[model samples]
Target: MNSNLTVMKSFFLLGFPGLSPKYYRPVSALLFFFYLAIAVGNIFILTFVVCEKSLQKPTYLLFCHLALNDLTFGTLTLPKIISKYWFGDGFISFHGCFTQMFVVHYLGSVTSFMLLAMALDRFIAICFPLRYPVLVTNNTITVLCGFAWFIPLPLMLTIVLHTLTLPFCKSNVIAQCYCDHISITSQACGENINIVLVTALCIAMLCLLVPLAFILFSYIFICVVILKMSNATGRMRTFSTCTSQIFITCLFYLPRCFVYVSNTVGFSFSLDVRILIVLLYSLLPAAVNPIIYCFRTQYIKQHLIKKIKTSRFGIQLNLSFL
Candidate 1:
């Protein structure tokens, strides 16, 4: 700690530097819409899974976990940015900012692990159907999902704690929509910046790459099993079940990897462009995940349709009596 370091109470968030102040209302409105969509879509999936007894299997349980994680992530990041644009208030307390950083990274790590769990479930079901029931019990899935949520806490906390020890004598204005590890740590004034950054980067890579490698290998094995199936209809049916997860996995991982790789390689984009890329990958997948599940997964689609029709029939029956 330096003697000249100044203690600050709060930090300001500068969102989309290139955008005009006049556009703030529209941007806020748009963000609010997205937040609403993310909430409703993921909540619907969770509600459907919880209420339907037939959906209590390992795959749907994993879907519920992903849905819950997306809902939490969207809630964590979107509201403050929306308020900043809508009300011209961007000040977040010093401790609050670090807390946000911890939760954001924590949820991201949990999601990566959850996706790996999903991949593993699919791999077992497809690659070794006969053994799946014995291997992937409800208790087994519960423990896997439990570890996904629990295992990342210490790593994320370590990064946040390390960043906290650095003295931020520079500007308190964060150059992005929200507080994140890189943006927050960049404000520190010291020679220890590189060490902190490298540590954070290594932890990030570990959290991201390890599960991604497993997911890729699992899918490869799954593909091999699918190809070996002699019947064309059976092959198509087996592959279709995994398509929704595949779409979501690609959507979540590919853009994120591109963003990280580009940053590491010094591929420069304008500040606003980089922020937009982050928002695209972080928020878009959450909003669209349930839609993909509903439209792509046959059982969920049928169940949703049946529920809608039953509600409509009940409403019509009440109207006739009235």
Candidate 2:
């Protein structure tokens, strides 16, 4: 350990270093906009699915799970960072930091598995159309989603527990918008820091790569099946159904993989640039997912339009009566 090492009871998040005080309100306003979009979009999806009995199928249920996960993630990380910029409060206790780290990682792992589950659902529907109804029921989807949320708990807990045992004597200044395993572990003071980094990297890659591999395979099979279709119109429609999911999958995985690979290859980004990349990859997908579903999914679009028209007609009727 270095001679300058000192115990750190709390961590300070230095969000966007060198940001002038004048920019604080502007930055907070921008982040609040993103959080609002994420909350409203996801909450709308959740509510719409619950209220629309026609959409209580396996596919929409899976969408609801994804929405719920995104909502939880945005709610978990964004509020504090928003408050920090808005109120000039950025200190976080040791345990609180680790707790945030755990949840961040756990939610990421859940999302990876959730994407895999969705891919599986699509794979079944596209490739085995006859068996899809029997094989991919609501109960089956519930089980898959439940497992996705549950399996990550123990693995992420192990990582967080191991990190908590390491002495954080180097510094408490986290150079990111929020606490994460890499950012937190980078502040540890010990000779075993490299080991911890490698372990964390391996675990993260395992969580990411495993589900990604499955998703890729599933999509490949779906594509092959689509190519074999006899009717061109059916082929185009089936392919269109998958475009939204493919877009979302790419959105979620590509940036994350780039960041991980860049870090592994020793490519360095400045603190502010790195945090911006993290925020974009982490939060952008959540904000955009509802929009994508609303526009791309035929059932959702139809139902949403109908609901809006009905509400408008009801208001018109009330005005006429008055």
Predicted model with the maximum TM-score: 1
Clashes of each: 0, 0
* Lowest summed lDDT window (length 10), candidate 2: 1-10
TM for candidate 2 is 0.96
Q: After superposing candidate 1, which stretches have Cα over 4 Å from the reference?
A: 1-6
Top candidate (lDDT) = 1
lDDT of 1 at 201: 89
lDDT of each: 0.92, 0.91
Q: List RMSD in Å for every model shown.
A: 1.3, 2.1
Q: Residues 177-237, candidate 2, lDDT per residue (tens digit)? A: 8899888988886777788777887888888999999999999999999999899999999
